[model samples]
Target chain A: MITAERKPLDEILSYIKPFKRILLLGCNECVTVCAAGGRKEVGVLASGIQMSMLKNGASIEIREHTLERQCDPEYVEELVPIIDSADAVLSMACGCGVQQLATRFKDKPVFPAVNTKFMGGSDRHGVWTERCQGCGDCLLGVTGGICPIAKCAKQLMNGPCGGSVSGVCEIGDEVECAWHLIWERLKALGLTDQYLEIMPAKDWRAGGGSGPRKIVREDLAE
Target chain B: MKTQSNLEKVLSGGHLAVTSECGPPRGASAQTVVDKAKYLEGVVDAVNITDNQTAVVRMSSLAGSVLVKQQGMNPLLQMVTRDRNRLAMQADILGAYALGIDTMLCLSGDHTKFGDHAMAANVHDIDSIQLIQMVKGMRDEGKFQGGAEIKGVVPKMYIGAAANPFADPFELRVMRLAKKIAAGADFIQTQCIFNIEKFEKWMEGVRKMGLHEKCYILAGITPMKSVGAAKYMKNRVPGMDVPQELVDRMSGVAKEDQPAEGIKICLETMERLKEVEGVAGFHIMAIDWEEKVEEIVKQAGLYPRPQV
Candidate 1:
């Protein structure tokens, strides 16, 4: 589950104020698990928006629909009829889904209801934390299971900053130092010696910093 | 006109403040959001727009509160410090304030996996304690974060925090409550309290610790309508206990009387909780059963607490 908090309601409402009828599309994938846009949430947001619009004397028609996975075109295509009738679309999916909808229905406008925060796992039942930055590299072996790119306050690849106090980040005293987490993981895996292996400079190519990155599995190619 | 600054007057003046919370529907449209909030208009003192209440993302609390505000009601934006750093929290707080939401409930939200999203990552960017401290700092220092000063007075929000006395190892729950009060929580709403006897004992302990002197505590009252609901609540809800007595009672009741029985239980709980000292009020969470709240409140004799 990629836990995401909803963006403010006002910002979301403002996006659909001008439209009379809007398609509220929810995704059952990452955004659903993240708590941003799920089927039930779509109901709540759609109903809330409809009531508010009515209260303000704006006649907005809200159609509710949820896709199995919005990131895929197959799921996005299912929303064609739902979106075809609405004035615009207020998608509760991640950025990927929203863009996919926009591309699929170039005539229809698509809006995002959530700000995709990060790629990670739940620390506990209801708390979702950012643990992976999607850096597109494999470095968890040497530094333990933790990824310094995502967990480190400074994204320090080499080691912990001296500013670390009792394993908490100094910049924000509340956060657990990523390096500390890394060290703990190393100790747990008996890979403490691996930390001593000096690594080369990070190659930014994998991270899509240069351009949109692509991965092609040779075996999958026809 | 009671401003946030004049909240003490409002609280002291014996106004039975009515507050309701909204869990954003799981989709993008606002109809469901608006419907719940609109229903709450004449029923609550203010509507609490939960920020992904229970850690499942639906609509943003700030956004939900904004909708409530548009509906001509005061909106208390429930904020969880779990997903955001100080920067994001402060920014969102400022944004919410600018949008006219003056009340904020500071919470350490549910662990992310508990809600609809179980596999999501958690951001312990700042805990509840540090969060209120930051809000208070922003309020008093007139800083817009980055230690820079904002142009006029920064809005002071009515700050509330959560207290779960029913959670296991009750002593730890008490300590957490004390921490929230010390963190500048102006009011406290307890977790869903099914057992008033247990809660009353917890209250006595709370009084002994002098936790009541610092903040106004609101007891949480949830109506359990059926054995199925009870089972789900007990089996699914973490750190929550729906007593077997009530479960047994529901099981014994006729199916038609199940909702009424649940309402009966809620009414009794509220009545009992009122007897607890230092208890300022009750927060009724119908949990999608908002329509029955008025009946529960009315049957509980909470009338004269105006819907306006």
Candidate 2:
């Protein structure tokens, strides 16, 4: 799932400081799973902002709303009634959701309350680790399911780039070397011979190189 | 011949070549680089100019290589993918070649977190292998990375890449070397060698795969300055394999004599490595101790580098 983290309280406070009436929006999707922009977080942020403003002797009316998913236009229309009443709309969703909200509610200023991190999942209850790079091409079949593009520091096709020390990446001890993990997985599956095969240079046009990518399905089009 | 570089002439002629490294100064002074090059002038075949080695910002390697060239010594310009994108890298390659640099070492330099600029974003548009292929493409095919044809003569350089035999998943190190060779790396210089036994094992794998026949393999040697240096490399430096016995030996010596003892140990390793098959030469990374390179080369019987 797409992961995100809450922006600093000071930065978020600055965005809403100019507005007398504000709407704190949250998404019930990836941000919620990551404990970043969920319904509970919206309530917590609303109270925190109110407390911060109360200390300054500035009285401001703040409202809270949570959408099923802010990326869809249908779900975004749910905010039509109260959208114009608020001076500004603060979205505690990923960048995509914030952009979608801004596009739909063209008049009101929309600010992103969270920073979208990467496409990853929670490693533990509160910890999240990156799993994929969305490189368009996936090589998990030969790599034993570990994504070197996302995990390896160099994003080496044929790696463990002379910096792998004792199953850890040179970047840090906490991070496991992607190729080391791949080698161990391949060995366990008795596919160690495949480790010698050289992975050719990637066609990065399909990855993050060409430009912003778009996929359209003619079959699903109206 | 792949360029008219002195290092290439020596290696291709089947002579045991010798190279040394010279880290560019942190400040804007070419005097430090020139002085270091003097010590290695007639002592080695080529001098590698490190590019902001360890990610600490320093004088550019291209400018340093030019200084070495001015001193009548061959400079193997080191290029790292950490700081430059493909366009900058390609332009630098052309600039280095135009400045008469004939040898190039491609690396995915040390991470920025290890240097003064910990928050700087790294622009690894290409890894070391792809960088080597890119250089080869420009030299052999006269084309840019995007496949645009060059208008005139392309930069002809002797391509080089680095290998670390001490890193984990040891069995795959040789295969990685093969990948670099297949990517058009004309030669390979390994990380500092302290564990001779481990390096010999890696060499055995290289011999089995016939990699030495494909490209020249120059083992890296760095003489430890003191027991603290040994311990630091063992514990702190990533991918370094400083054996405990060497540290114990250094610890047994007086503080003042540790440098000499370290050189003696390096001399002994070079003598033993001379007999190892597939050992093409030695790359002495004297670090800040460049003055000792001449003495080390002489004592190791590598002085009077064969005139090509």
Candidate 3:
């Protein structure tokens, strides 16, 4: 499960103070699981904004709506009436929802209540860490289950560096060197020999960062 | 200790000490809050400002409590540890005190799921009883919650808390009250009591545990004037239970006499509470009916303290 911490109340409130009407939107995907943005979060933000505004002597109407996945146009289209009616929109979803709302409602100002931090997953309750780097190619089989691209600070796919000391990272004593983790996983998988082999070149194209990437799934298309 | 003593005198000596709760409005608005605070100022002994009541974020309870203090009324700042960690809770307590709001009501608070922000996570750093113990320790030993010594010793303020005799099973209610009293709770406000017989039995159990000797317990009473209100309290509110008889009384009475009927029931409830040996006082939560509270007190003949 993905886990996320909520932003402070005052920070969320300050974003929507300008407009009398706001569309407080949420996404039911990863943001919901992590709790940064979700249906329940939207209600909370709306109530908080409403209560703060009322207590401060300014009464603003906030309309709340949560889309299944704000990144998709189909989901964005569902919120047309809510977006059109409001003077401003507060998207609680991560960067994707914020961008989608902005693109869908170009006329209305969109504010992000959550600071989208990283592409990661949760370890356990209240603990989240970066797990994926979207590094253009699949190489997990070569390095056991661990993704060296994310684990290594420098994304060194080849092997552990000279700075690795006692299984700890060189930059910070607290951090367990990712290469250390990579070695441990390889040992456990009975693939210790895999570390001896050198890694190949990295293609950043398929990672979706270099350019606008698309997947045309002909099987799923109508 | 001067204000401490003066407040004890004020509370123990009666003087129509009033307390009201701000449900941290569903949405934020200053006018409604200011109006509610102003309404309670002349009427109540002290106003209990809720800290994120029901976990749906509104104005900060400390901020609201300070606003109440600014309005010239004593505010018992309510703090819930559901959303904050231990460090923030301790800091906010001192902050509230520094802002001239002394009295505090420490609660475990409702689950975040019951709130509008169910998506919001819960941080149960310490339970309500432990929180009281921590504060009392800080005041008595000049130590923080972690047992570290605090720089300047601050005299302990009058710490009040909640008890729910009607919600939990009879045994657990008394046990919880004992635990709270043992945790250095100066005073306790019970959940609203409708069944006087059950309340009397509960008091007997409390006396047996010797809890009454250690803490002053104020019985909580709610006014059920409308049918809708009664239903909501029964179904929605977790710990509160208004008996069927009161609902019948409200229904039997004519529309015009509903107010009188409610007043009569409440007055009788208070009078019956007076007969109980351990009930120190009553905490009247009349919803929006503050004016009726004075009338109920007068009818019950609770003047200048409960004849202590």
Q: Which has the better lDDT: candidate 1, or candidate 3?
A: 1
Candidate 1 docking quality: incorrect, acceptable, medium or high: incorrect
**Model 3 bad stretches (over 4 Å):** A1-222, B1-7, B11-18, B26-29, B153-155, B302-308
Worst ten in a row by lDDT for model 1 chain B = B1-10
What lDDT tens digits, residue by residue, belong to model 2 across residues B1-308? 97888888999889889999999999988898898799998999999999999999999999999999999999999999889888899999999999999899999898888999989987777888889989999999999987898778699989999999999989889888988998899999999999999999999999999999999999999999999999999999999999999999999999999999999999999998999999899999987899999999999999899899
- Residue-level error in angstroms, candidate 3, position B143: 0.8
Q: Write the per-residue lDDT of candidate 1 for residues B128-217, one digit (tens) a residue.
A: 655666687678777754578877658678788877666543434565566667667888877788877778888888898898877778
Best by lDDT: 2
Q: By DockQ thresholds, what CAPRI class is model 3? A: incorrect
- What shift in Å separates residue A111 of candidate 2 from its native position after superposition? 1.6
lDDT of 3 by residue, A67-162 (tens): 888888998999765566888888888887789878877877988888776778777875678877666587887877777666664455543432
Q: Please, what is the whole-model Cα lDDT of each candidate in the order they appear? A: 0.73, 0.91, 0.71
TM-score of 3: 0.56
Per-residue alpha-carbon lDDT of model 1 for A1-222, expressed as tens digits? 454556788999989877888888888988887677999889988888878877888777888888898888877777755666888998888788888888989998788888877888887776788888777888876777788777865455543533344566644555777766776777678776565444443555687657997778999955
Candidate scoring better on TM-score of 1 and 2: 2
TM-score for candidate 2: 0.96
lDDT of 2 by residue, A38-98 (tens): 9999999999899998998987888999999999899999999989889999999999999
